[model samples]
Target chain A: MEFKNVTVVKKANIYFDGKVVSYTVKFEDGTTKTLGCMQVGDYTFNTGAAEVMEFLSGELSVELPNQKEPLIIHSQATFEVPANSSFTLHVKSIADYCCSYAK
Target chain B: MEFKNVTVVKKANIYFDGKVVSYTVKFEDGTTKTLGCMQVGDYTFNTGAAEVMEFLSGELSVELPNQKEPLIIHSQATFEVPANSSFTLHVKSIADYCCSYAK
Candidate 1:
């Protein structure tokens, strides 16, 4: 799959000292998303806007706010997180993902 | 800087066990580029097409073919590699780069 006719930022968004990296993609409708990857590690992210994370590959376990237990994902999956909230991820392997933000 | 009116592939091009990761960006005129990053490590890459590599940030020592004493870059720089040739890199620090292909 691909995103056509969009604007892609030249620089990358480096996080966790480069363990997490993403590029910002902007659509014509004023929506923005990030194509990102996470190396095998644990990370915590605080979100400003609500987000939907779509995984393309790899295995991971996510801890969302007020969740009973961590969500274990073996393969491709999608998950949502609320705005002004935070989540944790234990990436068992290299995880490739796309994250779209709520406007 | 950014590329507008382009198509971005959703999946990442993972290389060397994810030590080097890149996203393919396609232009309207049948041109292509990759927005990529490299973690601190030694890597060798062979190119199919001639490429111009533009560095966004980082420090590294590069060994191009037929050159003595690797080129050391402390910040932003650009390097050209011939098609069907190989180059080696000793990434002293994480490097973010954009590579454009000749067509």
Candidate 2:
């Protein structure tokens, strides 16, 4: 199966100064998922299994707990829904739930 | 091709209580990434392409800029290296680099 990005996640590598930066990835969506932090050195992230469009920007914002930070990854999200599987993703946002996903 | 998850990114959801929380993901790795602000209601994130077995924990930690928190996502990262493509993901970490990746 091929992939079409549902959204894009762009990550930037800031200079030692912390204020300056370099950008990688392009964009991402709600279902898209990633691991680790998105900073200098060797950052990491990945795509979720759902498509998010109906949701607003604020809705897509994933706020970590306490003092954890959110990763800003670049590049669109793409995943080939597995073949003959029962698991599927549900599409919605933190603000307003708007879609249903199933296989 | 199938995925093997170079790393895993796990996220959690907090109750209205705030201080308390609920864990969803099992584990993550260095290449994994996330988006938005992982909190109540809905959240989003993605996976970074890279294997970090060669790195350490502190290396897997993802720190965002300003006050942006990082999403604690669960699950593994799996991407099928296209059958024939020049662009391939390099595996590494933000700490103690130890590997080279390419197709």
Query: Reference contacts recovered by each candidate, as fractions?
Result: 0.83, 0.01
Output DockQ, candidate 2: 0.03
iRMSD per prediction, in order = 0.5, 11.4
DockQ of candidate 1 (2 decimals): 0.90
Give the fraction of true interface contacts kept by model 2.
0.01
**Candidate No. with top lDDT:** 1
Q: Per-residue error at B54 for model 1, in Å?
A: 0.9
DockQ of each: 0.90, 0.03
| Residues B33-95 of candidate 2: C-alpha lDDT, one tens digit per residue | 222111213211222433222221111323322225532322222222222232221212222
lDDT of 1 by residue, A1-103 (tens): 9999999999999999899999999999999999988999999999999999999988999999989999999869999999999999999988889999997
Measured by C-alpha RMSD in angstroms, how accurate is candidate 2? 18.5
Off by over 4 Å in 1: none
In order, the Cα lDDT scores of the candidates are 0.94, 0.24
lDDT of 1 by residue, B1-103 (tens): 9999999999999998888999999999999999999989999999899999988889999999878888888869998999999999899888999999998
